[model samples]
Target: MLNSWGEDIDINTTINTLNGVSKSSSSTSINTSTSTNSASTAKNGDTRSSKSSTKSLANSAKLVTKPVSSTSSFFGKFTGGGGGSSNSSNNSHNSSTGTNQASGSGSGSLTTTTTNSSEDTREGNDNLTIQKINASIGSIKGEDIKWDFWKLLRFSNPDKELLKFIRARKWDPNRSSIALTRTTKWKAYDHNVNQIIMDGEYYVFKNEMTGVMQNLTLRKAVILGHDLNDRPVIVVRPKLHSTAQQTHEELEKYVLLVVEELQLFFKEKTTTATLLFDLTGFSLSNMDYTAVKFIITVFEAHYPECLATMIIHNAPWLFTPIWKVVKAWLDPVVAAKVNFSYSLKDLNKFIPTEQLPKYLGGELDYDLDRYTPPDGTYDIHLNDKEKRTILLDQWRVLIAEFIKITKEWILSENQSENKKLWLQKYDLSQKLRAKYIEMDPYLRTRSSYDIDGLLVLE
Candidate 1:
């Protein structure tokens, strides 16, 4: 099935396990591989709880790219075939007009129309802008920019993606061209960023901070319902943050993941979203300027025209100094959207209380663990490089364990007896198979009748 973004999503497996009890049926097939060592049954009469796992561009002349399916026909309206004019110029030459002979004979009268220079000039500028953007994309591809893996994967629609860089610089061809080229080089050179995504640095963070700070609950920087005009409302709880607990990089990754995830939640590709910063628990410890700077840079550089309005709720006196610095870094368009709310009444002007979270005097209560990408959105499948990284990580662990076991066996003088005992105790083959499944079940599948302890890779 196609996602809201028009990207194909293949949901190969759906296993439901509630309270450690596996449920297998036609509706919900159970394909769980647990470390039998951690299994324990809940009381029959006790209540059981289940928690599900959950996981833009542009400026004026708003950065817009319809879904691939729609864009094929949509862009045609802009560059379709048809606008030609026939030009006929009537020339009169006097050769022997001494006798002033009034001999005028015309076969047909030809008339030509003059086109609007201002209108044509605007069109020319737009075409030139698009060309420059394309050239920048060529450079990025030629130089092999680091996140260009999306292109290597052959995910369709290069023009649509290139539109993002074009709008980032406000449709300025020269500026956007330089911006795209520099961005590609910057990303390619940043080995640390490669480690951040490829190394799975996000997994190292505590689930609590990652879940909350990432706005998984729709309570913290949650994407609530839309405003009156239908722009999505994103509530951000700055109080929930502590730089000591979460590093700047981890926070940046969470922001990137959350923003991208929210993009999928939009029913249509929206150019704007309402932002609410709930700074009720404003503390000096939460003042991580580095993280703030990084977040702003990503929004301005990569996600233009995404912010429709921003409401800062309950800003303490101490935050004034910090806002002073942050305001300077923000774009004019973005800075203009900022609205500080002293109370819920002020915030209600932009977003109704009904759309706000309960803590902020809203009617909704969000559960983070039960969160899925809102509206059936799934995680973007890992590109080939990403898949390789994950596989390598799993293989590295397996090889380490194998080497450790081999070394122990070699250290023992009685190899035969030791081998028999080690095989019987560890059940290496079955353990490895189970480990693989635990690491990622999508890579392997098993039958309902398959026994856990007996299962082994060939």
Candidate 2:
């Protein structure tokens, strides 16, 4: 099965006698003869294998590539196929073209002619009627929405003559909406979630300036223990006016529901703590769940213990959090060899306010959340090169420490002392370092996941 966004999902694992895939250990490292460990992934979950699957398409387009099953071929009573013409999109949407200038009404009703030559009748169990297809010019510009929607004016709908002008497309707005709403049908980057992966995802957030509506949306849902995007988990948009009807606590409860849906996806062989977040948009406005979300999730999963952190990166006020996280990553690392310390970002938050004044580079716009050094001054003065070295050192050290901790606590305590070979499989210190090294450039440079994690909801 494919997700709403065209992610192919496998759900049979849940229903069959079989269960999740068997998990193997990560590549281990030791001080003995040189040995290399490879990431032998299990089948129960997905790892991002299609690295280039989702190339960014045109700004005015999005791709939908789900393979429609026979049972679901006709969703909501209509379907469309064929490449569209965007240049002419404007011609069909001329708001002024309407016959009535003041009320935005046209003299003729819009209609659609079905291409199926054999089928003349509106056979489906729907309220479809034959109507004239009048081209609507661009009157309302919605993100990823290509077709000009018919405007329903209260004043015009009352007259009998105006009622004759109501003929519209034969397709349901909910289903037919994709023809105009889906922007790109590009090749998706296919990668199964790594059993031990550090991935970040985000959702697009939408809100009304009127403050009457606020909600999150995802094209598809990720099922647990399986690949999320292309699986059985229901992919749904948050209800309209959700913020008005939904409380923050209710949102969190649904978050837990997502976790439960994905419970089967994590097998015992996998031990990495991954993060998943929903990006609601760039503005939190009256909502105040930002800081609480971080404290309640993301950091706690990876800080104390867990594999690499994962995040579903979309939401309102997205820009601020990103600025803060990246800036935090830019703080200084203090060490014995360093006479001068450069800011690596994260540690800068905790530096005393008095000490903050001493640091050469400081970020004033960030929300330090009270860890800011008292008086906001610091004495450390490190160059860019020094800062880079400190960050590398901190990351590498953490890798080593993680392996050691896992060895002491995760290994079977009851195993015989002579049979220690199994412990080697779990010592992934060096391997972890290599993984970070590979991703560091992108993480610091592009922050590429931002696109997938965030949606521009107007």
Candidate 3:
């Protein structure tokens, strides 16, 4: 049932698409509204079932199997430097073509033998469940239960961390293994991250004429609240374009910063998040194909299962055409996780009236200036710019603290433990990055617009 775009989205697609709703509507029964047109159904929550079966096969893991020479394979060059230390376990190659080989002689392999789709899915779910249970009991590292700061930082919570990789790789151990390796490799660049977070002007968009990146009203995104699972729910308005001139690289860094902050804030509850794209007033002018592509690529490729769900709200007919183009970049599993809402009523089914924005048929009055007050008290007398600055300062402090912890931990550990941690970081980051780049072979050839689609306002 796979289509040129992905797969035949199934009934569960609708059910799972509203995972956020499952959290709030304890008493309400969810009834999906069907439309005559397929696109209408797609737009109204009748999304395609997760193309998980096809992806469960290792052959579909482009990130793991692809040659390491590609420029987009940034983590591939890192070589998981510390995983092969004297005290650590040995990595070994799996016979499977789709997965990356382990670093040492450890009996662990991602998934070497191919299983039927049913068996594969079952195994993947079982493993994820086991990881979740282990995480609850604090048994992440094979029976060793002491709370090591290195392991805690390496895995915010082992079960949730593994869940991100599992979701990204469709529960295939081999694919998840490769993904984990890439993430471990990414940790070595903490010093670079320290620099990036401090350079507020470089990270956040700045006006071309004034050179200030601190305007609160121009900010297009914010963390609204948490979902039922207590994962942070982030809201983005693609229509709200930044007046400041920003490059794709800078935009990516800023977004990554936001993801890091969210992870830190919700580390105790859930490592992932939910994204809501408000496309009600979106026009072709709002389209920034390159920036949008970069954002999606970052989440799907670099972040992995950190995404719980993405709901596109109130998209006009015009957005549908653009979505088809944009959807081409999404992995089947990721694509399946997206739900399109054509009306506030459609959104109301899954999201309670209280949790939604007032404009979208909810009671919450979200203020751009004081939506989130750092001190829990909002001084209404303060102007918008001042309030915004306070918010930014709060964010800076949070980011600084995160960087400080990560760097200090890495430095305090021995070489062997350090290698193991870096290996873990690299595996996740690489697998995510590789997956997206693999899908877009012409990623380099395309200009920014070609990457973003019509959503970006020129």
Candidate 4:
């Protein structure tokens, strides 16, 4: 079956798309009027669906596979990752921890307050999940897991890596372990994400039939500035994207490349990002369902809790029906993060006027051509491969030692010993981060951020 973009899609996917409304509405009904009225003061509001609307919505929805299904074929022949069934297990931890509450002041500022809460059971669950993740680390290693990138994340901040999966699965250790393992396998064996980073701006392919060379990074998405919370803002111009420009595989690679690049900007304090979807001049032809599904899968399964907010700006009436079905496919938590901005003032609430793009009623004049790294800039890294390999080997050894200490920390009963082991792990993680910085030149291609000295290596 052909999707809205006229791309051949699986028959089962088409069927699922047709049935999305029935399936999604049963669980969470999207009040179109309520949503529109809350986000925009436009008088022309309509909440009506006809048979033709259903067909169009279904056609658009075909770009999105079943959200909870594990065997979606958008990302090559991978049988896992995206959404997978969780395996449940019993937990015995009963400890309580302090809770931090942030209250907003009258003048648009936040005040933090910390208090001990006996009702807080998250700490105990977190400890149990960490122990479970540590135990499964050995079995999940090999060619399937991108050892270099995984080690980079583990050594940089092991707790943060573990907590992402744990929190995504709601502190269910078994499910978290399963999701983490599957994602690693998908990234390494299925997607070859490490190779994508290595390829960088050189990721291109020529269509033999068309005799046209297609660059994967097509300037459709650009990292402009930071949000109010200092999260890196990825502004996506869907109007610039078309399925005819590249093959699905190329599009997938481009999307993953952008995601990996974005991850580099992440800090300990800023773990998430804000996606600003500028839908100006967007139409049916601009929709790429496969790309959309792949993005959803990556966020929900692979990179959980990585998106702080997604602002949809200047959405036209044509997109309303598509969004109705699309929002239903999203996880409730993810859906909740979606916000609508009808005007420049609405956007300024999340991003400052100084950082906002000029087109979006802000002062920042961001040109994609200027923001993109010039040709041959990333070529310098090719010579550093040998140095990168040596550093990687060293990191492997350090990670091995860290893992041993991690196991000891998980099992240690003495509070003092636990604290000491934790400090040791932290020190090792910092060393790992340093090692990554040393190997960074060889591993990743330089972006515009590096050229302009905007990216500070910590």
Candidate 5:
């Protein structure tokens, strides 16, 4: 069931591999000298199946199709290039061996240009890379919706993060949570057939605490379908919980939930792909070292052969340090604010301070009173590299603290104690960050280091 290419193809693993296809076909289905008649029995979309006898082509070639039942699994569909007006034209397919070729086992080329397309739709569930996304498009499914085009098409636009997150979010557009799979449960004396639980893993909210207009979305899509060719694929989407009260405390649960869900997907794959997933919501704050280290563990277990790039939608300069901090390369940003952090800082050493950042001129102070609701916290303020600096340092410390706490939580099994709800609350993700602020002494604790201190020590 390999495509035209000889690459080691999968029957279900469509996680992160959709770069391009090899445009080469041999005398595929070159039938006999004469045309024969055959009966059509059944079909399963994009393919026809039945027991038929059309003689000559290869003297005899075998084709078989099982009866398609109401219940079947679909990995996903390819993205379709939108429709456009076309000049009226009539195209005909008349080969010198027309009837002769028609008698072959299969039909003609998989591609055909119509009013909708001027190019061959080389779209199937192939690998999706930067180059392929630029070349052409076809049956794009929810899981196949990617964000490599973030810079030019998306991030460059308004709400770039939101757009990038949506495109990068993965789902088996063909599959719905409304239907549950059949399962068998063990009984005391016998086994009973039961329906599987449909656990829809998702949640959403906006950050009212900031007083700025921002929403967080969380969703996870697990891909486990044999494609037309019977290759396996797995698609994953992390979570984001945005609320006016969203804080780092709530963010940790999303991270924990993501890690837990990913473990389930791994069990379904024989060997996994590059632990593929995306972040469409708050990239920097939502993404952390603990969350990242967990994914790196997945890559080590699953995708040992190749590299995996986890795209971050709308992650400004702040999120890049995640790469620096973890000492791993994975966070690929689509559209994010520029002129800050490690990436910009490295580039800035060559540039001037006045020419520093477009967003950091600090010329006008945004009215915090208007943007945010009645809260002691300022919704908007003048450009303070100091505040961002505080956030960055504390975040690093928080990541360290999270790792220690996470290990303790797991290892604490040997020992026993009564820790409060805050321990359950502060699992280290950002949405949960708010709950941290609402409770505990950590809220009043300011960063001990300053911007200059970070520069010197870092």
Candidate 6:
């Protein structure tokens, strides 16, 4: 039978392989090692032989090598294609474009398009849309409530964030605002996300269930490196999972912890991430539907436009049905970010060999066991209520100033004056971010990245 990606497979052979029943005499059967230890491990659900077969299939897989023109196609398809004109155009625009101006309605309808000799017209439209969003927030009766909404969202780069919502909602400001507000409330009240960050739930769980948390942490997922576009790469090994291991609540908290850690890696340009799922040695024992559904919900609803690509590597035939079911749950936009990879070469198309892990045919020799956890000593001084309160009060002042300038920037008709206010707003936003960093050690627990010196505060 042929799988969705057009890969040929013998269902009977796959079943026999999973059952630890050898069929080496059959021409279609995968070549097997005669080692007793390998057979014993497969019988115990380790599936070493199946992993070998997956690697063999990956080596022989033939994939399309043509270039794709559409931005969605470049990131979405599993074909061994190059990113074409669309990617180059975006790169050029990012590098060369300066001040953006909105050409559409003052309400930020995103209906008009324009061109300029010196700037990308889309930047102007996006900037105008963001201004409209700011204007909407400015209209709220209570200044404290308006600033509190911004604080609840909890990340620097308001323009970049607002743009994400706008693009996710197809450039409709009204829809984006609704989506943004929903996320804000969900994170603040429903999830109590700030408390989760403050409690450092992962560490709390680790202390309680040392053996399970240690094993899961070392094997399940890690933010290893970056992809070609400098987006953070999260490496997830599903084969390490088992439904019997962790409770639904514990699993949810662990996933949230990883995501919270991921936030520290985001820059102005690199807001999205590449998720690489290594499916080698995967079997029925590894399936966790509840965990999968929760993860899907977290990304699709709360973290919109945050996935650059999701690479499913070396998936066995057994995963096909599960993938079909999973695909149904994904939003069409989220589904477009999914890609299948059959080999190391396939992965290299998105992540360079230098940044890729050595086990995945890359130069980086990453060892999760060697990773150091942060000690609970970095922010002890901030435990003083008075000190922390003063810093937070200062932040509120900065937020007030930022919102004030942003409103002026939006209202100004003079090009030069608008440009000046834009710069002022930009500077205030940066200061707001810097202040957040100064208070981060107090607000949240230190992550592994902090211990490893990978967290860039500036």
Query: What is the C-alpha local distance difference test score of each model?
Result: 0.41, 0.24, 0.41, 0.55, 0.23, 0.55
Q: Name the 10 consecutive residues with the lowest summed lDDT in model 1.
A: 46-55
Q: Looking at candidate 1, what is the lDDT of residue 337?
A: 84
Candidate 3: Cα lDDT at 277: 90
Per-residue lDDT value at 92 in model 5: 17
Summarize candidate 3's per-residue lDDT along 1-458 as a digit string, tens digits.
Answer: 22111223232332233222212122111111100011111112321221122123322322223221111111111111111211111212211111243233134322334357864564454344333322232212210111111122322433245456666676564455455544433422321332332222222333331322332235566666655565667778877665344555556555665564454345434567888898877888878888778677667766777787888988888987899998998888789989988776776655666777777777767654342212212223223444433443332233223322222222322544444433443343333323322322211122112222311111
Q: lDDT per residue, candidate 6, 1-458, as tens digits?
A: 54211234343443233223221121111111111011111112433433333232222210011111111121111111111222222211100001111243232111223265433443343344334433333322222223334554455566556556656777453355446645654665566565566656345554775543654456588888899999999999988888777777777767876776777788755779999999999999989889999999888777877899999999999999999999999989898989999987899889999998888889987775565555576647536656666666676566546544543443344656654655665677678778887767656666667766767765
Q: Write model 1 residue lDDT over 270-380, tens digit each, in one string.
A: 446787787887799877788788878767775555677888879999999888989999988789889898877887788777776666676766442343322211123
Q: Which candidate is the best by lDDT?
A: 6
Off by over 4 Å in 1: 1-168, 183-220, 367-458
Best candidate per TM-score, number?
4
Error of 5 at 55 (Å): 50
| lDDT tens per residue, model 5, 1-458 | 23111123242232222211111113221211111111221121111110111221111111011111111111111111111111112111111112112222233212222242321121121112211322222222222221111111110111111112222322221111001000000110011100000011212112232211122122233332222222223324344423333344334333333333222222211212222233334454355455456445333322222122222333445556564665534333211211222343442333333332233232223221121111323223213435543543443344334323322332222222212212331334332243222221221211111111210100
User: In model 5, which regions exceed 4 Å deviation?
Assistant: 1-217, 220-270, 274-283, 301-315, 329-458
TM per candidate comes to: 0.45, 0.21, 0.47, 0.66, 0.20, 0.65
How far does residue 46 in candidate 5 sit from its true spot (Å)?
A: 34
**Candidate 1, overall lDDT?**
0.41
Residues forming the 10-long window of minimal summed lDDT in candidate 5: 180-189
> Mind giving the per-residue lDDT tens digits that candidate 4 earns over 290-344?
7888899999999988999999999999999999888988999999999999998
Instruction: Per model, state how many residue pairs clash.
Output: 1, 96, 50, 1, 53, 2
